[model samples]
Target: MAPLMLFVVSMAQFIDIMNGSSMTVALVDISKALGFDSYSTQWIISAYVVTFGGFLLLSGRIGDMYGHRKVFLLGQIWFGLWSLVISFSTTPAMFCITRALQGIGASMSVPTALGLITTTFPAGPKRTRALSVFGGFGAAGAVVGLLLAGAFISSVGWEWIFRFSSIFSFLLFVVGYVAIPVIPAKAVTQKIDVAGAMTATSSMICIIYYISTGSASGWASVQTLPVLIAGLVLLAAFFWIETRLVKNPIMPFRIWRLRNFSSAFVAILFLQGQFQGFTYFTTLIFQNVMGYTSMQTALAFLAHSLFAVVTFTILGKVLPKYRLKPFILTGFGFRCVAALMFAFVQKSTSYWTLPFLGLLVHVIGLGTSVLPAQITALKDAQNEDQGVVGALYSTGMQLGAPLGLVIVTLISENSVDVKMGETPVEEVMKSYRNGLFGVVALGVLGAVITAFMMPNTVPAPPAAASAPTTAPVENSTDVATVATVGAAAAVVDLELDEALAEAAEKMEMV
Candidate 1:
């Protein structure tokens, strides 16, 4: 039962990562089918990410307030339905709409899934192993998506990706209903913080939308600056409301006080941004510049993916007994090496020099950072807050991809345009160099954030044979609030259940 539940949780997480990577391969084909230019088609990818990242906090909070199982199932059903819509989308606008819906579903599902894993296992070796497998599967899914996308696009059609995801999502939904244990609410009737949720969601949407459209529409265009300004303003407003307005704000400012958690979040943001940015541009370099086929590109990524899985598995077994900070530090060092190699990649550089060696260094770095960071955050989060905190961690990751894409694309777009003249290979390489430099700068900043902010040794969750463990919670005040909310929520749930039962009886009579 424990293993089955773990698989269900990991599978849901896999779907989220797979959706992003798979869609990336299908981007070219989808553009041709939907009659979109390069600029317009980018939205199909960006829109999903924007919505997914924006809603993560709210979705995770919902799981914390209500029940992880309830929210997870709801997210799955909605995602499956939206996937069906996407498979048959006739226009870019329709595709974008359904894509956003799919993001919403993913947002709902991911945090709750992570929370469920944490809730089901105590914060010792069991939880550590589970999280390791979870992280490994996530990396593995991206690799699988790349391979599957290539094969499906070549043999079947781009539409099959959507169809496959839709089927897989539904099957998971069904499996979840049967297997996932219902986690009782840790808090009573928690009043929904409608105002805070709306403000944060709207702010994120506006900021991301502005970034997504700004380059194509002209950064100075009438629509861009105002939207960007508004988003920042609203985000500021959200911070204020969370701090002052709500009794139980969605993302309590208190969580940030933990030096380890706060630093991890920041480093991951930069780390994820670079990670996502690398995949996008590298794929372009291989397929567009070097004229490598999708299958070849997918094959290239496999080595990195395999290495990541191996590292995660090893980390899972060892982290429970050892300190994680050193591993994190070492990880960042590897990332720096990888970023430098990629930054100076020559147009004529063979696979052995730039692509293969650079990626090997990168994957090693990525595994080191992620395994330690995820363990650090969840290991300390209170039992109740695990769902939302897990969600926030993932939001940092998902946000990085689109945010990185927008930033790097803006920087590199001007240099890579085709014209009526002879553009040298060196010029193409120059644009890539610019993007890689951006990645390297971010990586250096990430290393600094991790080294200074994270502690030398964080207290681990008490092992079975060691001292008695208190529930992992950095903030006592937040824990008190979660309890109060959980208490209030039970009454409302009973009332809701009764009302639904009555309504069902009435419908049967009719």
Candidate 2:
């Protein structure tokens, strides 16, 4: 039953993540069919990203309060319905609007899916294994999305992408309603932090919008700079509200105090940024420079998906035996090496050579790093806090995509002197290589943070033998002594109750 339920949940994650990357190959086809200009075409992707990233925190909290399973079902129905609408879209505006709504649906499901896993499985090896499988499905989804998009575009049409998604989403919703256990919401009486939710969501939307569009629109232009500053201001105000005013904040600040939490957060951010940047540029180089068709480009990434699947499966069995630090550092090391290799790609280079090898190495690094980072972040969370904690981790990933693209786009643009018209292949190659070096820099930064900040090993629970036992109470003095001991025991128990609640309260109040 657990395995079956995991499949349903993991499949949901896979489908949601697939939408993020599937558009990479399908975008050109979509642009042609919908008559979208270059600038407006970008909105097809950005609309989804903006809504998805912006709504994640609020959705996660909603799941925690309203029952994860219920929210999960609703999200699936919403996603499926919008996917159907997208397939029928005749205009660019309709497609982009549906895509944005689809993102909101995804935002609702992803964090809750994670919340369900963390709360369903007890912490330790069982939960670790579950997470590894869940993460593996998510990682595979990106590459599979590309592969399927190419196949669909080459054969039927791009509309089939959304049509297929709609079918799968509806199937998952039906299967999930039966397979997933109905866990009750947390019993806390506090209302949702409406003000905090607004500020946080608005800040994310503004920041991500700026990051996604700033390169196309000048960074200091009226459109980008003001939004960036407004986002920062809203972010600051959100923190102030969370720290000072909100009795129950949408995002509690205490989760940051968990062991290795901050380090894992930063590391995953870098990892995701590099991943998005590398894949985006690689796809462009394949089609624009090397002149591969969409199908050919998808086939080129087959190695990456295959290797990631294998590595993740193996890691699920072996990850419990080792410490996280070594895997994290080694993963980053592989990423740096792969990006460095990609930096030298030439127009005449064979797909079987540098690009192929780089794909293999990059996926290996991703498998090695991402799963452990997820475990590190979620392992210490209290069951009640799992939804929001997972949301924070996922939000880092969502933001990283646009942030990574922005940085690499700037690097590539600045590196070459190509004109607005058709440019030579050699100049384009040079630009891509320079952009890849930026990815290498990101990998190096992740490695440095992992080396210095992440602890060598996860803290283990105290052995049962070390637990204090109470003797029979005999008299008044002994009863008093027992009371004192009981009070101490209760404190210890609270600390051991995932160590997130009372500690978070103390830290926030201070």
Candidate 3:
């Protein structure tokens, strides 16, 4: 039952991730079918990203206050319905809007799924192994999405992408209903932080909108700059509300005090930024520069998918034995090397050469680093706060994808000084190489920050003997009573000091 539950949740993750990656491959076909320009086509992806990233924090907190299982089921239903709606889209607006609505569902589902894992699995090796499997499926989903999207597009049509997602989502909902155990809410009395939710969600939407459009619209243009500043201001306001206004904040400020959690958040942000950007450019280079069919482009990523699965499987066994720092560093190191190799890629480069090798190394980095980060982030979290903590970590990833894409797009566009369709093959290659260098720079930054900020080791769990037990006392003699009282007093003092220290540390971190 436990393994089946894990499978259901993991497949939910896989389906969500696969939806986005598959859409990437189908974008051109969709654009042509809908009679939209390239500029408008980008909104298809952006719409999903904005709503997903924006709502994640609130959704996570909702899962914590309500029940994860209930929220997960709701999200699954919402996602399936929206996916079905998207399949019938006749215009870009219809597609984008339905996609955005679908993202709301993803926002609800993902963090809650993580919450379920944290609550169900006891911390330490069992939890670590569960997280690794979850992360592995997610990693595999990205590549598999590409593979299936190509096949779907080539054979039937791009519309089937959403149709399939809808079918899978509904099926998942049915299976999940039976498999997932109902965990009760930690605090049913806690009120939703409406002010914080509004501020945070709006700020994220603004910031993401700016990032999504800045390259195309001009960074300083009215459509981009004002929204960017507004987003920042709202973000500042959200922090203020969280710290002062909200009694039960959507994202509690205290969570930032956990050094590993904070570091993991930053690490995942940079890691995802590089991954999204790298994948974007590589896909373009394959289809546009090398003139490969969509199916071929998808096949090119097969090696990456295989390597990621194998790496995660191995890491699941190895992680419990070693500290995570080395793996994190090694993961970033792999990314740096892969990006550098890609930066030198020629138009004529063979699939079996640099492309294959780079994919292999890049997947290794993803497998090595991401699972460890997920484990590290959850390690210090109290069971009740798991949903929000996971949400925050995922929010970083959501934001990072668009941020990375914008940075690379801006860099590449400026480097070549020519529009994509109009550029010569040599210039296009040069632009892509320049964009990869940006990924290399991001990798270096992530590695350096992670090395310094991430703790070398997490504190060990308390021993079972030290844990408080509720069994009635067998004896109530005076000497035994006194001994019990003294021990309880000492424990109380120790707990108070620990709590105070944690409070002070959280303040300092903030």
Which one is best on lDDT?
A: 3
The TM-score, computed over Cα atoms with residue i paired to residue i, of candidate 1 is 0.87
- C-alpha local distance difference test of each model: 0.79, 0.85, 0.86
Prediction-by-prediction clash tally: 10, 0, 0
lDDT of 2 by residue, 1-510 (tens): 668778988999899878778899999899999999977888889889889899999999887767778888999999999998999999999998989999999998899999888767656666777888998998889899999999999999999899888999999999998998765344444589999999999999999889888877879999889999999999999999999998788987878988677789888888998998899889988888888999999999888888888888888777766788788888888887888877788888898898999998988888889999998888776656788988889999988777877887789889897653488888888888888888888888879977888888753343322444333222235557767987998899877986777788899999
Candidate 2 lDDT score at position 245: 96
Alpha-carbon TM-score of each model against the true structure: 0.87, 0.89, 0.89
| Cα error, candidate 2, residue 297 (Å) | 0.5
Query: Which stretches of model 1 miss by more than 4 angstroms?
Result: 185-187, 343-353, 410-422, 459-510
What tens-digit string does per-residue lDDT give for candidate 3 at 1-510?
Answer: 678889888998999999999988998899999988967877878889999998999899888778788999999999999999999999888988999999999999999999988877766666778889999999999999999999999999988898999999999899999998765334325679999989999998898888888877889998789999999999999999989876778887888999989999999988999999889888888877788999999999998888888988888878876889888889988987888877777778888888899999898889888889889998888766889998999999987888888787778878887676787988888888899889888888999999999999943353422444332221124337757887999999999999999999999999
lDDT, model 1: 0.79
Winner on lDDT between 1 and 2 is 2
Full ranking by TM-score: 3, 2, 1
Q: Report the alpha-carbon TM-score of model 3 versus the true structure.
A: 0.89
What does candidate 1's lDDT look like per residue over 409-494, in tens digits? 66776656643136666677667767776776667777787888887765455564243433443235756876787788888999
Deviation from truth (RMSD, Å), model 3 = 9.1
